[model samples]
Target: MPALFVTGTGTDIGKTYVSCALIRALKTRGAVVDAFKPVVSGFDPKDAAGSDPARLAAALGDPGGVFRIAPRRYLAPLSPNIAARLEGETLVLDDMVIDAMARAAEVRDGLLLVEGAGGVMSPLTDGETNLDMIATVGAPVLLVAGSYLGTISHVLTALVALRAANARVAAVVMSQSLDAPDLNQTAQALIPFLQGAPLFLAPRGESWDAGALADHLLTDLRAP
Candidate 1:
């Protein structure tokens, strides 16, 4: 099974947006796509209309509902470790890995999209970060970042951290941030500093389409 781990420079940087769009695009191309958000915080079961898990489930055609998409969720909008602690719970790294791998196995012939909770270094447990999850899962990463002031630095810094951990970054997506400057220009300026990972721009707008972006990724992944 081929799995792509989606992580961001930080929270609210469009990780879920990119993941959902890509999943839709892949499905448009006749690919069986499934996604999982291993752990989610700030989720309210009673009102999940605008939640990340709900959005993800919708993207996956609401397969088995939001709970199936993200099995681990907390009400506190904080780091997973802190949120877990606040509720008198703890996250076990091995257990998480087991579940993720099992889910991937279920879609062995399709794409398994794993979305991280926050930035690569965001804590999954007291001693584990999202970086560890990526490494343990051995999936290529798609780093999502916001196009804002100082974004280039943040993207490059995140690249360095992932590289140090020997994680393979498939690409870097500069998603348009609220009230940010032109995203295309930001992507252009970021190209020179992105090492070799391809830079992509996700324009800001409600009707923005990701079909073209999805084509680029499929072409790259299917290359001989």
Candidate 2:
């Protein structure tokens, strides 16, 4: 049951970036890891290599992992509900993703990182949000947020939403954004709101000590 559901305040908030970093970091420690992105939109089969699942699959050491990892792939850059509908398909969240996550959890023991699509409130289907996905998995969350202006409110709001869903937060990463209201300042302001969850500030680009963060999570999560 060692898994982390990496979700963000919104799309493109570095959830995939943090997930891949943690995957590589865990791999470096000789840990068995698997990443699952149940649904992905804005995906073009022609450019599959550049998709999020493709990148995650690469991190999992599988080049063509997209085929096996994400079962629901949509063409449009919209929400999964719309994306699936546009393709003449319907995404019943439970039908499409729940059992897949359950199956992935059963087979993978080391670390299963379930990367959710879009923000917590983003539509996953006609009736579900990413929050429902997190609730369905019941995995500890590693909330990813950016340091841009208004992110303090965004992160806190996301955290509150998770709290409302009764999701256990494993950790939080304030992934640096290109624009900002100051990284450290934003992080400082967020500390008291986490209800004791640890927060890490990652560099906007590479050079983030993802391995260290990985180690911390492994150690901390396992703590008695």
Candidate 3:
């Protein structure tokens, strides 16, 4: 099974947007694709239908579309470790990793998108970051970036983190931010720094056309 981990420079930086879009695009092309959110920190079980996990499940046409692939849900809108602790629960990384691997294995000939929470370095636990999870999962990354102020720095820094971990970045997405720079301008500034990882843009209210994105990922685009 081919799996891609969707991680971003920071929270609310379009990780879900990219994953859902890809799910639809891949499905349209007749690829058996599924997504896993794994953990959701700002989840409200009362509004399960409106949660990120629900949205992802809905994209996959899963019936009852709520928390289909999101195993851990927390109430607070904080880092997952903190959110879990507040609810008197703890999210075990090893268990989550094993579950993710099993999900990927079950797909066999298909593709799986494992979406990470928060920025690449954001705390998963007080002792581990999202990068740590990505490392353990050992899947090629679909690094999502924002089109916000200082996003160039954030994107590069995230790349550096992934690079240090010897992770392969299949692609980088410059998802548009509110009141952000022109997509092309920001993307142009980043093209050279991408170190050969393909960069695509996800615009507001427009289809992101994940064809090329999928092509790069499935071909195993590697980081230098």
Best by TM-score: 1
Compute the lDDT of residue 125 as modeled in candidate 3: 78
Give the alpha carbon lDDT tens digit for every residue of 5-30 in model 3. 89999999888888888888878878
TM-score of each: 0.95, 0.94, 0.94
| lDDT for residue 166 in candidate 3, whole number 0-100 | 90
Ranking by TM-score: 1, 3, 2
Q: Which residue pairs of candidate 2 clash? A: none
Whole-structure CA lDDT of model 2: 0.85
TM-score for candidate 3, please give it: 0.94
Residues 1-224 of candidate 2: C-alpha lDDT, one tens digit per residue: 56778899998989988888888898999888888777899999999999999989998889977978787899999999999999999888777556556756675657778888998899998988989888887878899998888898998999999999999888899899886778898899889888898898787665566987898888876666
Score residue 4 of candidate 3 by CA lDDT: 83
1 versus 2: better TM-score goes to: 1
RMSD of 2: 1.6
In model 3, the clashing pairs are none
Span of ten consecutive residues with least summed lDDT in model 2: 96-105
